[model samples]
Structure formats: C-alpha cells, structure tokens
Target: MNLPATGRRVLVSGASRGLGRAVAQAFATNGDRVAVHYGSREDEARATLDSLAGTGHVLVGGDLSDAAGAASIAGRAADGLGGIDVLVNNAAVNLPHPLATTEYKQWAALWQQHVSVNLLATANLCHLAARRMIDAGTGGRIVNIGSRGAFRGEPDHPAYGATKAAVHALGQSLAVSLAPYGIGVASVAPGFFDTERVAHRLSGTEGEAIRAQSPFGRVASAEEIAAAVLWLASPSAEWASGAVLDLNGASHLRT
Candidate 1:
C-alpha cells in the first residue's frame, strides 16, 4: 500500500523499541531522514536504526530528563539534518505505584521521569524546533504519543496517567501557541498496546482482562498506532493540527 510521503527530516524519540520504533520505521519507509533517539538500551536502538528503510537514519542518545540536554539534542539534530521538519515525542515511562502505595518519594521520581520525557523535554525540543522552523519560514509538525490510561485511569500507574493527560493538554496549547510561527501540534493516544516492553505489564490474566474490554478483543499493534501518527504528520494532516487521534478500538468509549 502507498503510505503518505513523509517530510525530508524527522526526529523520533524513544525510537529503539515499541511504538517509537514502529513510528521511526514508518517515516523512514516513506522517505524521511530519521534521527532515532534513545534514553538507554543502546543495542536495541542500534538494531532499530539498522532496520530502517532510509539511508538517512542516524542514532542519537541522551538522557532526556534534563531540560538543557533536551534542547541540545534538538540542536544537534537540526544541525545534522540542516533542520528538522518533524518531531515525534514518543518516549515515556509508566512506573506502577498505586495511590495507596504511592509516597511523595515514589511520586516525585515517577513524576520527574514522566514529566521530563513526556512533557518538559518534549516542550523544550518543540520550543527549539519551532524557532528553527520559524527562522526558515517553513512550517513543521510535532506529533506526540500519549495514552488512553490518562483520560480514564490506569489502576496501577498514577504517574503515567497524569503525565499523559498533561501531554494531551500540551498538544492543544502548543497548537495555538506555535501556529503563529507556522508550526503544528497534535497527539496520538493508543489504548492497551501489545508491545514487547509491555509483556510484564499485561501478561496472563491481566492481559486477558484488559483485552476483554476492547471491542476488537485485542490490543493494538505498534504499526497501527504508527500509521495514525504517520497520517497526522502527512501533508493531508497539515490542516489537522491540535487533533488527538484516538486508537483505542472503542475500548474506552462508554456507550
């Protein structure tokens, strides 16, 4: 099938595995110069990099928890690619801590990681990237990956849900704030996904229980979510800024 032809330059965070890897591959397949960023898991990141479709793939690594580091990462990518035309904020964490067991210490740690990777770091990159686009007088797209657990509730991971909610909100805020600079922002939230990393989180009974709620009786694949993201960043979605495309399979919808 013919997919949307991606932009010339793209930066995808958390691109070593899961949904991030899927997204990076999708863009690469469609002819985008993709910079794959990884927080850890150097081997996995490299594996994904080697597996991409385009020769323009580059592997970049940095701990995104630091605001300065995040900005610097953006700068490096812009310099390497001459300028980044697309930024995909897909790195995330969901440390499981129920409200009952959640203490300020745990909450703070989880909050820091989730907020930094999911929101703060993303915003930092967006801030820098938007300026680059503005200076070039060319518009760009920022696509963020969020979670359905945020809008509803993830019984075991309060930090994940809260941070994703913030991500959702940030997308909208950036849409209006960055539009003047000719930048667009949007989010894609996927429900209970069947990813390699999620093996422990949703296995045996737990996985089956969650899958029951999905009308399709299954979790979504990384490619499914990636396709939605591709469509969002495609030229067709240029006029679709501020959209939060849902890939929940009607599981979260209450009739």
Candidate 2:
C-alpha cells in the first residue's frame, strides 16, 4: 500500500488551538484536507479552519469523553474529509491532581476524565478510522501525541502521566496489529512546549525553571513538535511505526 505524499484526508482532534492547531496547519500546508475536531471551541475551530493554507478543511465538534461522542467524532470526520488517511489523536485532559493534596473524589474524577479523553477516546478513534481504511483498501497512518511526563513522571498530574503512558503503549500495539493492513502507527512524546494554554507557566520564575528543564535553555515551539508529527505521518515514516519518538531536548534521557 503506497501512501500518498499529499492531498490525504487527515483528522486532527482538539484542533481548536495550540499543538492541535499546529499539526493541522502542517498537514494543510502539505496540501492535505483536514477535519479539525474540537470539544467545545467552535469559534476557535473555525479560526483553525480559516487559517489553513489550502482548501477542503472542515470543523467537527463533539465531546471526546463519551464513547458515543468519540464515535460521532470519527464518523463526522470521515464524512467531512471523504475518508481518513491519517488520524492524529491529540485531544486530552491534563488537570493537576496531586495525590497528597487532592481529595479522593476529585482524584478519582480526574483519573476517569484523563482515561476517557486521553486513552479510551484515542483507542476508539483508532478503531473507527482503521476500520474505514481497511474497508476502503487504503493504507493509513496514526500519530498519537504522547508526553515526556509518561517517562519522567508528573508528580502534580499523575493521571495525565499514566494515561499518556497507556497511549504510547497503545500506539505500539496498534502499530503491530495494523501493519498487516498497511496502516502505520506511531507516537510523539513531547516535553515542554509553548502554547496558549500554558503561556502563563512560561513566564517569570516558573518559565525560567521550565526552560531550564531542557539543556537547550528553552522550551519547544508547537511547530517543532508538529513537524515531527507530520513526518511520522508521512509515507517515508512507515518503518518508524511502533516507535515512540522522544522530543524532550535532553531534559530526561531514557537509557
């Protein structure tokens, strides 16, 4: 199965802003049609759609925390893009839930939320899109946005860390399972990146420390991570399937 170099149908979840937006833009600029999925940011999603470099981009909105919603999201994206050649599972919930300071109720709820959005939704969409690809007889790619915290740990956001680890593992498993179908699967585990949601944390003392985490003395730009994601989804990256590429700038090395 030969994947097209451009003009592929791509679906990017949580594309209303930040990393999602960058990924969408990258694909769009590469001449692919994108289905930009958002949870509750229709206006921002439209902004993403409008900012695309080419035509055929569409907006898809649905709650990713619900199973039905995940199905709907995949269905709509497939319909909008005509078909899905690439699925980028980037939507996630990452609220802080330090075990010691958080109450049981809140901790449990956050864990559930993170699992639903970060892990389960991704699994569901992968199944949905992979089915479509198999039916169409078109090989595809799946690029999951994991996190460096999965390896280094997230003391303040245990659930986020745990779910991302699951995401990485899922991508590897699917990479093997889907290879027979000509579908490549991979993941990107990014460390600190500058985005609107975390802009505040990148300033003052906190910003200094965050930058210090990387030997480069700087956090990554969303575009840098997006570029890696774009490559992993490309036709040349099929051999990279089942690999979790680390983009941490030497912050935390895994030997």
Candidate 3:
C-alpha cells in the first residue's frame, strides 16, 4: 500500500533502453533518486534522465563486463547520489550460437560477453553495494534481472541461457550471504516482452503466435516488468528477498 521511496537512491544498469529504461522510470516516479547507467547511446540515456520525476538523477557510462569497469561504474553511481540504497542488475548480453555449427572462437566470444556482464559484473557491483550498506548499517536491496530462458531454454542461445541460470544462483547466494548484513537480493525473471530485441528476434507469424500464446493474450509491456522490479526493491518487498518471480505470463506452460 505504502510504496513511498522518498530519499531512497537506486542504481539501474543498462538504462539506455528496454526494461532498464522502464525500471529507472518506475523508481524515479516513486520518489527515489535514480542513477541510469548505460554502455552506449548517449542520446537515449539523456532521454531517460529527462524523463525522471525528480532531479537527483545521474547518467553514468562504463563497460561493466570487467572488474575495473564494474567498480568504476558503481563508484560513479555512488558518488552521484551520495550512496546507493538499491542496485538493479538489468544489463545483459544475448548472442545465440548453435552448438553444432558454432565455431569455438564464436562460442568463446559469446561466453566472454555473457559471463562478464550477466555474472561477474553483477556480482562485483553487488559486493561493492553491500559493502556500503554494511558500513552504513541501514541495509540495502539488490534485484537481479533474470529470464525464462533458464527454464525453457532458448535455441541457439546457449550463452544467454547459461548466464541467466547463473544469475538466479548468484541472487540467492547474495541474499543469504547478506541477510546477516541487512541486504536483500531477489531475481525477477520475465518471459516475453515487446522489447526491440524480442521484436527483432521473432518475425511475422511466429512473433504473432508467441504474443498470442500468452495467458494474457499478448506479450508484456516494459512497464509491467518494471513495476515488478520496483516492488522487489521497495521496503514492502523486504521479505521477498531471494525469491524468484516468474513473470512469463504462462507462455512456457506444458499442457
């Protein structure tokens, strides 16, 4: 009922577009100071900044796939808003490589991008954020964006699926490890959305079918998923830590 996040600060990675943009807007609308981090597309990032409800917003740039880059980005976010009370790991890499015909070099390249951003970088940011929370003694929230690919598996998207599966484990582990320190970690894995990525991947009848097959008779809007992420980080969702909210709209149901 009381979803007020006044004075709270949040950091959302990959905020240039898609789910990240929506999540950033959700938090900002709820009175939270937001930091929108993006790897590229300065214009899109600027648009996100201008769209927020409040003024204590920041736009950070860095490639978080490496340890140094991750730390630097987290530092900038922290510095901008004084500190970060919530961290949403929504940045990801999705490159499909069929197992049979995929070159080893291709596989490794995809592996590097996926593991770095989806796993290592997220874990690194969590570590930094939790440390701040621990020192402040006020606790914190962390929401990791996961996918249904972990469950149903995406054809040719081995790297994507693997990283998403690992993301769940990482969130759960962080939840337990930081529970004593007053930090809550959760995963919100969604199925299909009308993101540009999704639209590009599916075409014509196939895309239409995928959208129609959902229990709701359509794919989710970015705002819908963003709302879920905000709840996970809100004070009301403290008890929901370490829980995975499967938001696929039952598209993967086995009949």
Candidate 4:
C-alpha cells in the first residue's frame, strides 16, 4: 500500500457544519476530494460542498444511528469519491441529560441515543471503510472525533462522555488491529471550541468561564482542530496511529 501525499479520496461524516465543515474544507484545501456527509442537513452539506476548494466533492446524507444507514453512507461516499483513502468519523450526538434532574425513561433513551450515534456509528463506519481499504490493499487513514469530556467527565451529559470514552478506546483497538492491513486509526479529543452549535454557551458570564478553563483564556477555532485532523490523516502520520491527541487548550491534562 503506497499511500500518496495528497489528492486522496476522503469521507468526512457530519460535515454539514462546524467542526465537520472545517475538516472537510481542510482536506479539500489540501487537494483531496471529499465526501461531505450529513445526517439531516442536506442543504448545509451542499453548502459545505460548494465551499470546498477543489472539485469532485460530493454530498452524502443518511441516518448514522443504525447499521444499515452506516453502510449506506459509506457506500455512497466510496462511490462518490471513487474510493476512500481517508475517513473522518466526525458525526456525533451530545445531548444534555443530567442524572439528578432527568427522568428514568429520558435517561435511558438518551443513553441509547448517545451510544448508538457516538459509539456504534463510528465503529460501524470504521469497519465499513477499513474493509474497503483492506480489499483495495492500498492502506488508509481513519480519524475519530472524540471529546475531552471523556477524561474530564461530562457530569451534565454523562452519556456523551461515556460514549466518547468508548469511541477513544474503539480507535485504539482498531489502530492495533488495522495496522497489519496498512490502516492507521487515531482519535482527537477536543475541548470546547467555537462552533455555531455551542455559540450560546460562549457568551456573557458562562462564555467567560468556559474560556477561562483554558489557561490561554480562549477557545479553539474549528480550523485549529481541523488542522490536527488533517495532519493525523496524512501519510506521514502512520506512526501516530493509536494516539489520542488532545486539542483542549490545556483545559484538562491527564496524569
């Protein structure tokens, strides 16, 4: 598997906006043809496709909370890109479901949602993409979007934190198993960043506190995290497989 430096085929899940959009743009800017995937934001996904630098970018939409949908997304992405050389598992669900205040049924439902979307979808996509990479015998790269809450704890969103922790572990396990097939797997644990989805939280007093969590007194831009994802998916980052790079602006440090 002789991987090229650029102009590869990439599949980025949840690329409709925010971090996903930034990641897709980064890869496109790097000369790779990207498959911009969205679960329910087709219009925004198309916008992301139009904003990409190079041509050949395509929009793929499907539910990722199930195995069949995962397969369909992967299949469409591979077909659109001709083949997948890199895959970014960026789709995830992070709903707030604090244990103390939430009802029992709501808690169980949210837990299921988080696990299905965050953990299972990622694992399923990895399997689908890696299978193609293995069959092609050309090797590939897979980058999973994890969360800092996996380590620091998501007391307000325990399911999100737990599922993300599972995702990190899943990437590590795949990094080991897929290496023999020339597939590199890695995960990025990003802390609070400036994204439209969480823009409200980054305002007034609460926003200040969030920014203060990092000694730098600032939150990261989507592009910053995208840069790291791009590097990890590059041909040079084969040695970095199995690593969980933290992009938390030093907000949470592990011992």
Writing each residue's lDDT as its tens digit, candidate 2 over 1-255 gives 778989999999999999999999999999999999999989999999999998988899999889899889999998988999999999998999899999999888899989999999999999999999888887999999999999999999999999999999999999999999999999999999999999999989999999999889999999999999999999999999999999989999997
Off by over 4 Å in 4: none
Per-candidate RMSD vs. true structure?
A: 2.9, 0.6, 2.4, 0.6
In every candidate, how many clashes are there?
0, 0, 0, 0
Q: For residues 50-136, what per-residue lDDT tens digits would candidate 1 score against the true structure?
A: 999968678888878798788777877877777888889998877777868788887778777777777787777778777887777
> Would you list the clashing residue pairs of candidate 1?
none
- lDDT, candidate 3, at 108: 89
Candidate 3 per-residue C-alpha lDDT over 137-209 given as tens digits, one digit per residue, 9 for 90 to 100: 8888999999998888878898898889999999998899888877889998898888876776468888878
Over the stretch 197-237, how does candidate 4's per-residue lDDT look in tens digits?
99999989999999999999999999999999999999999
Q: After superposition, how far is residue 96 of candidate 2 from its true place, in Å?
A: 0.6
- Which lDDT value does model 3 have at 29? 89
Q: Which stretches of candidate 2 lie over 4 Å from their true place?
A: none
RMSD of 1: 2.9
Worst 10 residues of 1 by lDDT: 1-10
